[model samples]
Target: MQHDQPRPRRANKSGIRQVLFNSLSFLLIFLPIVLSGFLICRRYGNVQWVFIWLFICSAVFYGAWEPRYIFLLISSILFNYFVAIQLARSKSKPLLAFGIVVNLGSLAYFKYLNFILQTWSSVLGADFQPVAITLPLGISFITFIQIAFLVDVFRNSSDDLGFPKYALFVAYFPHLIAGPIIHHKEVMSQFTNARLAAISANDVVGGIALILCGLFKKVIIADTMASYSTPAFHLAGQLQPISFFDAWGALLAFTFQIYFDFSGYSDIAIGLSRLFGVRLPVNFDSPYKATSIIDFWRRWHITLSRFLRDYLYVPLGGNRHGVLRRYSNLMIVMLLGGLWHGASWMFVIWGGLHGTYLIINHAFHFLKRKIGEQSLSVLIASRLFSLLVFPAVMLSWVFFRSESWQGAKTMLRGMLGYNGILLPERYQAVLGSLNDWVMSTLHMHTGDLVTFGSFRAVLWMILVTAFVFLLPNSQQLLSEFDRSSGLAEDGHLRSRMLAFRPTAISAVVAAGVGIVVLAAIYAGVPSEFIYFQF
Candidate 1:
């Protein structure tokens, strides 16, 4: 979803400007100019000038997509800034409420109006053609950031650093489109004169390391996975049958595809922000490795989870209430969190499914505590993670990725083996009657997900699985270099040998990786990250 433009660019067929982190134009043209301009501004004037320059550059980056929406963005910033200062001065709850309403109102107008229309049409049994409402890119993220700032100000948590700095925080291109959903507390302190003017060698090296690694993830691995996954999903959408092997293969491929895609985007964001000596909150943390739904939420999209906890859950009375209320609150948060990603019932269902998983996970913990020993936590964690959680997560992804409920149902049925297993034609000769039974009873089809052979799909799964489970993440690799790798104290690196060392050999290895990434962008087709639509 971060596949957007920088500066003024010729419009694509969709009328969206054609530049993104994946584009060579961004890599070769835009980033260099912004970085140079930032340094020049920092050198020539005060920190305000630095922020102003960055703010303007950020506007250009965003406006490159649709120049009209830049006005909406600025209007939102100015309105929020004015109200935040007023709320801080007056301590008026009404002022804060008004600010939040207007912001949410803007979001609903652009993002949810079409959704509302369709829902009404269905409910009323009246055909209503949806209105054309072009969503402002990153409206969801922008609204959240501004609302957080306003509330934080009202709470007297973070200082109002004036408009210029605040605008830069909102418009900062790296995390602007898709985000870690940064807190005012996480970034505002780094806006000071001393921090912006200075640069660290480690930041440079680590940042470059992160950006290159992210590029590889997006352009090569994620895109490759997409090729295996998309057609299968499309088949399901078309109401066609999929074999168990094909469905599972496609599901697993998508699981890796989204992970790598978002992980790539997050790394690029953190790394790019790091280049400016500004640290963003960590977004992804090898979520597929998480042992429980609770643990998965803790690891994946961390800042968004934190935001939900702090802003929504706490306000709704959190776990302080009785068990029933706590469970209720959990469902509400998860459902809204799902809707927050996109205005779709599919996302809502995905969120609800996760909510149920969390409730079950929590109930297991509660019941176990009453009946058994605390010592079983780690052992149960491993058992549950492998046997239950991972498979459940993969299952939920069907709804998450599918365009229609029918598609999701088809995929789910396939995974459960109702749609049957795909066996190779060679098995017909080996098994005779059994092969006949396999052909008819198992519903082996010629045009199923893995029609050619299961070999390629199976191999892809192995390679991606190894990359996911074996290797240290970009954050871990850069932890030694960039202090804001956000690796928790308890977190462990898979291998110290994988650590980034500032040596000649490491540089050479990095160069090799970079060249591979460059080759990938040139040779491979460009794809937008999944979250970009949200």
Candidate 2:
């Protein structure tokens, strides 16, 4: 019933500011000004002056999109700050509850109201007029950060860092828009007298290297992968059936694209924070290498996982109550997590798929506990299980990538070979030459197996696969060189090779990579960070 459809083009908006971290403008102009200002303030004025200037600069950066929205951001911060103050002083449950409602209400009003209206209209077959609403950039991220702050206030777990420091925490610009979703305790404590006055050589070197590495990931790897994945997913939206090979190729391409894109954003955010002499938490750690869904969550968008686990999963009674409660909690957390990403049914389905995967994973673990295995055997089994887990992860991405249920269904059907398969026309003659007997015995003609338009996609797959399974991640690469910062140093074999050092060769390599990234940004079309939508 479906035919090929044209894919909707993505709007090329980079961020709230015209300057993207991946863009040359941020590198050549905006960053230098901000960094210089910070340094100058540190030298010439008081710490309060530095904070005030940083806040002003951050406001300009955010307001670059629409000056009016900056007021929303400011209002949200002040309102939440006041509530937190009241909550801290009175320990009133009512105030905490009101604060939670206001934050969520603001988010829902901006992000979901239109979607809700559309859904209701369709369900009731009623004509409904929906009002235009532009979602405020980074509302989802900041709201969650403030909510965490409020909860900490309620628990009496956070220090009373005054309004100036707290405002800086919320609108720091680096982790403000897209985030590793910083914590109050870690970030607030670091904004001390000593940290404000200093910018170390290690931080500068390490930070620049991270920024270049991140830019390479975004401009080179993620963007290249997007070209392939976009059209393939577009085929689904057009209701066009794809071949088995095309479906998998596209799915795999997007898998890498999103990983590299968002992880790249996290890397840049952390690196920029470091340039300011503050360290944000590491977010990604080669999540695709994970063997289980549980392991995958721990490694991918790690701070989001931490937030969901600490805020939602734990509050839902966690594993303490019963097996049923625990499973239900996992489902709830993942479903909300999916909804948190976007206002769409497909996202919900994507979340549901992961929830199911987690349940099955836990069931398998329970069975294994009952039938205990040797350590060596378990390790081997886990490796094999990881192979199985990856394809399942890819399958869930079908929903994530598709715009609608029908689109997802079309892609899934193609992946299962429900749609007839054919090799590319270029390969027909060579495949036709295969011995008839060999073809008959195998029940597959050469024509039946498709070639992805070119071998380029396959090559990309191989390269990214090697990187995921073989190469050390950015965090691991920088681990040895910078001991002062809390970068992750998980003892994986591949991770041990590239210990960052302030050597001539290291400087040359970093410079070369930086030059290449800058050239690419100028040469290639500017694209938005994938997570900016979320």
Question: What lDDT does the true structure give each of the candidates?
Answer: 0.79, 0.78
lDDT, residue 463, model 1: 86
The sequence of per-residue lDDT tens digits that candidate 2 reaches over residues 307-392 is: 99998999889999989999999999999898887777777788998998898888778767766755666667767877888888
Lowest summed lDDT window (length 10), candidate 1: 1-10
**RMSD vs true structure, all candidates:** 4.2, 3.3
Residue 320, candidate 1: Cα error in Å is 1.1
Error of 2 at 291 (Å): 1.7
